[model samples]
Target: MSVELNKTLFNSRLKLIKDAWNNASDSEEYGSIADVGAFLVMAGDPAGEDDPIRKGTAFQQIKGGDNPIAIEIIPQAGAKEPSNDAIPRFVQAYISHSRVGSLLKETHTGKLVKEWEALLAAANSRPELVEISPAMSSFMAVKDDEELKIVRTAANLTSTLLANYIATKLETILDKEAKISHEDFSAQIEARLGSGEGDDAKGPDMKVWNKNPKLKDVDWGSTELCYSPIIQSKSTASGYDLKSTAESSPDMIAHSGVFLISTGIRYKGYCANMGRTIIVAPTKEQEEIYTLLLGLQADLITNIKDGAQIRAIYQHALSYIKDKKPTLEKHFVKNVGFGMGLEFRDSAYLLSSKNNRQLKAHMILNLSLGFADLVDDAGKKVGAENATILTEGVKSVKDTLFFEANDEEELKSSKPKKPPVKPLTNGHSASPVKNKTVAGKVLRTKTRSAAQEEVLMTTAAKIREHQIELHAALQAD
Candidate 1:
């Protein structure tokens, strides 16, 4: 499809986002966020095609064993093409509510109403409101399929809603000057927004909520957000973004740390992932590095094209990063970007190694970079990423700016100046990375302690007893 046509389709989808939100927010049962906002397909390993778990999804396999969504077509009784417009052409439809389980809850009844109100107000007040409206959604357009349009629109709109929610929450926190920890911030977000089954909250209210007529026995949906301290210590090499359920707590050395919050929300049936590394009490150098990386990210966004080769674009970014910061040449990570859609990690992936593919119109991708303080690993130095929708032209997804061009340019022009830097450590000199091996080495196995052995034996005994009971029950049946 032509780029213009795709954009028209995207604009149409944007209207649907507002419609879905309005319908769900004001009404009780429709559920906020559409049923399936984005149709994302991830085929299992081709070898596993026969496996029961992987059987029904895909049939055609690519070189890397990734498969396309499976489909079956039968001629409609004497009709040329299927008259049912609901019938999809490319992939079979499957609905999973794991993402939007939270929307079903009564807790968000008030919040959704308020959120929609705020979105409408903010959207209307802004002079550059055209940018976020369905008309200006050129960044990425959905495929030319009606059902797919519904799915993509839902994902895009819900993402915007969550982004606004987080932004609003942060405004409140900042206004109060709350000295909150990452865990607390994430918890508050989950409550203010919604949480999935994975993050089961426990409390007297939760207990009562489960049994309450208006709130009981409801399925709360899923959202992905991770908050953590950016810097722990000199030796603790931790990434700012990680799993939502990870238990690694940041040290309270100075009673403050650079909190990094990353979120991946599965709203309804769509997914939206975003991350932010903020400095509550940042050092001079920390602030400098963050500014530098953000500027670099903006520059990279400007260079992206719809039909560009993903590898070439990635390599160019790597070169740019090296030029900007020559001191820590050895501390750079390999991945520059990756594909994000229905699944957290899917294609069109942005890998230097995978140059065979070119970014397509409406393909959404993430561009991220990581920097470790070679001088002080404990003093956090990292670059975070936000999701960008690939339009026919260049546009980036930033926190406040969103996909709008006016704000994006204003922010870029007023961006902080790059800090002074020392010359390259070894003049970009580096030896080839050697693979480690201990040839002919004998591996030793340690015997389990008596306490461990006893625990295992007792567990085995219980399992055997359960098995006997199950067998007896089966025989009786």
Candidate 2:
């Protein structure tokens, strides 16, 4: 399709999400008072058959049938106490449950009962709108019509807030170093959401956005994580992105400094993953490095085609650079680009194993291929890469990842662009990482809990087994 059509579709999808937020379910429609009342009385319904107390009379009914896809929500008074819900928001175990159960929960029953149970038990708040339910979590975990809206909304919101953060936090960082603390900076962003830090506000448990290091520190400002490995968007750094929280763990979280990346924005339960690499003044080396990384990303993504073999794409990436030159290896593209939703890197893994898997219909994958070269620079390196979606007829997911460089007009126009070839070595800067973002905390991120790593190893084994099965089936045919 034409570039105009591609952009038009992306904007349209984004607008729908904003509409959903503007028209969220109101208090009465959510049946908050009624849901709370019913649960309370189930414990003790003393009123015989017609007990007025047994049924909720506190709220009015919302007219339905008149409106399809009706959603109800209640903005209860800020909770005096934040209840603990034993939901597994970030556990790897839940990843195993996604495939079939996710589809079932959408038009049928939900997958995580424990998460929903938490809300059912929060009676003290008399919270007409208790959380800890399948609603928001389901949106994150599943990719359906409604869920897609949330993701698109989140992406747009992220860019909007990013301007505010860049002006308020990052842009003024070195100049106002003594004046701004991390906590103060974070709260500023919170306000834009009609939410902020108070004694009882929710934790920044936005796991899907994939928190980076700047969020985890106090004295140091951080960069935002652009392009989660799973979603496959290009990064401001111009280098490819790091993969899942499950993979990076505490080891990677240590490097999060001046994180210019963003968790995008959240609408209802859905959120988008947007990020930028944080840099101070522009150096000739820095500028050149950025161009190289970004150019590779642009070229590779635009070339994506029908029946495109993974190995062919892999070879094309390597060809861009004559030498190894921190080459775009086949393994990087193959292993990254997963399904986007509540969690990062859900449903799919990008690489093919022993079996050569072809792209299927409606599968959204992140082709997060990026690289850095230490060539000719004194020492510092840079990165560039992005994500694109594969659909039979719809526009590519690449539209969402492209930005005209909000304020970098001079840089945009001025370019002979660098030579495509650079030395392939371990000399350039290291790749980006994702995991354990603690804002204002002094301690280091805890290493990957051995338990979680064990689960990952087990998952790896299962993938191997599945590959064998696929290979056998393919061979039989």
Candidate 3:
């Protein structure tokens, strides 16, 4: 597919974001000063193929996992207990109640409504197939094979657009602001691509939206305002004058952390998951911390065996980091690995017990670890990553190297920054990182963890138990 068509998917996602933003805000909405509005609704991982989530409804129904609706999606709004994550109510309503219009087949709503009513009745009455509107039955049924391709195309296109944006502009965005034009950017990207599932898939030939006379098309959804701390927009001068503004705000720090959680840009149906932490202006201490964390991350990824006990990875990280800072282990900790697919946090936390679950092959996961100043991010003991996954292979974030355009000046005018061999420093806390290798791609190794089949069998059982509970919960009122 041409990059332009992929951008079209982002354009639609932008519309959806704008709609949600208007729903939330009543004040001047010229990019809302911060990207909080945008971030909350940003896409996580896409729903699995087998997952019943065709559109936004599944996110509403589950209200768990990384499905934009997850309680931990954004550490909960106005939350006093930072440890307790809750899905925002407005977000929930918009996703579930309102998005039914966006996600379900637009032409099939009235019938879907009737079918929902019918299904409600059937659920209370009987499980046997009963005569019903085709829309409802189909909605409740597995997605048609054709629909899957279209939706997947739509989604992958979005991911490609967002990934390109992040890859090309992420650093510039973080350091400075830029004019973002969803319309122009979308048009540019989608114009060339065709619609399909693979990287080379073609985007829709014509505009995929409607052209009726009575109503404004608003056919595709979109983002809230494409606002990031460093602007990543593609707007025009006459339409929306662009600016590249960068500043430090408490909001930026807190939300940037959250943004890192959902860094993979949302598009079409397939979601992307990637995150990186860059200290805007790093102190000597912060630089050291980044080095240590990056090194520890390397160790974690290298040790991720297909069947290794979950606890073993944790122990390796903890012990290795302890080799650097023995006393650092005294502080609180989170999960080191987790499954990633349709959601960011898929059925696990960063600090999960190996007794509860074990790593497995073919599971896409984000193995995260966060360290604080002998404390946490919030009053609740500064926060750090709490998850990783047990998988045979690893994906490196540095596979596509990004160099700051301004990095030339920074390097020429400044001292040559030496990277830490490993993040194992003793005693006091090392500072946070200014530049980072996001996820496993930061490392340049192809080593895999040892076989851990025994632990895998046990963890699989626990996952099954959790999944059964989840399915029942979804079926519940």
Candidate 4:
């Protein structure tokens, strides 16, 4: 991709999203498409006996593809690196900075504001399309917090929908619910994205796409299982790509009862990412590691705030690994988390090193940690292990955490009371909390009132119903 071509494609896609969003206020097809993500999926070349997957695909989505949304998964193109990768990054950078950059730079005043005004002027050169009475007012309107949120929602929707698609597809194949081969599965997923069945206006769900296909005469036992996983391609920071690949590890998929999914998408120009380790049936050891990872994640999320030290946080995770499980020493990636925004990777990062940078307010951080390969004594990976014994493989958990200016400032001004605690010789605090006893009992009462029980049951039922509806929607597509 050349510089000029890259710019052209980016502008075109950005225009597409913007037109859709602006028109969403009136048109049914656009429907709040503030964010979008496009990616390339390369499967090993079907034409050759053995060739690096020459076949790849790229997909774009708006607002989770509900309604008549703008989404497409172009096949035969975007297979090569540096081709489809640039689209999402450019989308994120342009939208994020365009909308939020002013808010971020309000501290500097004048220069940034003028720059934005000029850009707005260029964007809406013909006042007829978007009336600009006062340039500053128009710019400010574009930067409205609510509008910013819509963009964030759009980006998040893109990622969430993609994740759901992958999970649903995997479940279909693994459970034998759908007799779909690897080659056809990609097309199936792509067609659903393009169906625009997300909105009620588009008609009932699952009606847009062909649900029933003629079963081909083929021997199921002879065919190999095909899977095409999705990954995020670009980030503002160069090192932050979670690249999607055409090929997948059969051993890991077969032996592992769990899979870690992580990816990001951009909407209205901002980028959002999500990651989770989905567990099927698990052994005791696997359960323990999973719990530990969750605990570490909790610690990071609670401690995260403006002015927190990145190096210190990373060191804390490392220290936790040392104290909890020394066997994972080798698999510890230097980074536990990093900044996320306009680009997949931002300027600040979490790592154990001597650095002076402190976290700033409004920074989007991706907190994650996991073991790459935990091989049991048998030398097989745990997730896809051959025997009941432990195995070598990968496991991880990640979540997006943000630092808000208002929350941090409120916490500082409140000056909450704290109990006195002594520091250990190791420079760690042992802040043991005193337990509160009720009715001279060590544990809290377990009995629930009828009203409370009813409320809980109702909530649970609603959640289950929602899950069922979502599953049906995905499967139907």
Give lDDT tens digits, candidate 3, residues 1-477. Answer: 221223444344445445644543342222231223112122234444333333333333222122232223444334354433233333343333312222223222343245334444533232222211222211222222332332333333333434444334444433444333433333333342343468866543233221222112222342111123221211211211112122112221220221221222223332323334433323344445544565565456555645656667777777876888676665414455454333323433233544334444333444556554343243433323222111111122122222232334434445744344232222223332234432211222212221122113333233333322221110000
lDDT per residue as tens, model 4, 137-231:
11111222332343344333433344356554554444443444333444444344333435632321233212233112212222111123332
lDDT of 3: 0.34
Error of 3 at 318 (Å): 2.6
User: In model 4, which regions exceed 4 Å deviation?
Assistant: 1-151, 158-164, 177-192, 195-256, 347-355, 381-477
Span of 10 residues, lowest total lDDT, candidate 1: 468-477
Residues 1-477, candidate 2: write the lDDT tens digits. Answer: 221223443345435334433443442212222222112111122223222211111100011111222123322224475643333332222333322112211221233444444543552322332431222221222243444443444444454455334433443443333343333445545544334358655533333123332223211111223222221112122333333321111111112222334333334433345444433323443334444444444445444443455455556656664343443333123332333433333433233332233433222344443333322234433232323111111111111111222233333456523222222111222122112112221111113453233224433233223322221100000
RMSD of each: 26.2, 20.5, 20.0, 20.9
lDDT of 2 at 391: 16
TM-score of each: 0.41, 0.37, 0.37, 0.40
Write model 1 residue lDDT over 327-443, tens digit each, in one string.
Answer: 644555555656543334443354554555565545555556556433335652343332111111111111221111123233245552222212111112222211111111111
Candidate 1 lDDT at 82 equals 36
Error of 2 at 26 (Å): 47
Q: TM-score of model 3 relative to the true fold?
A: 0.37
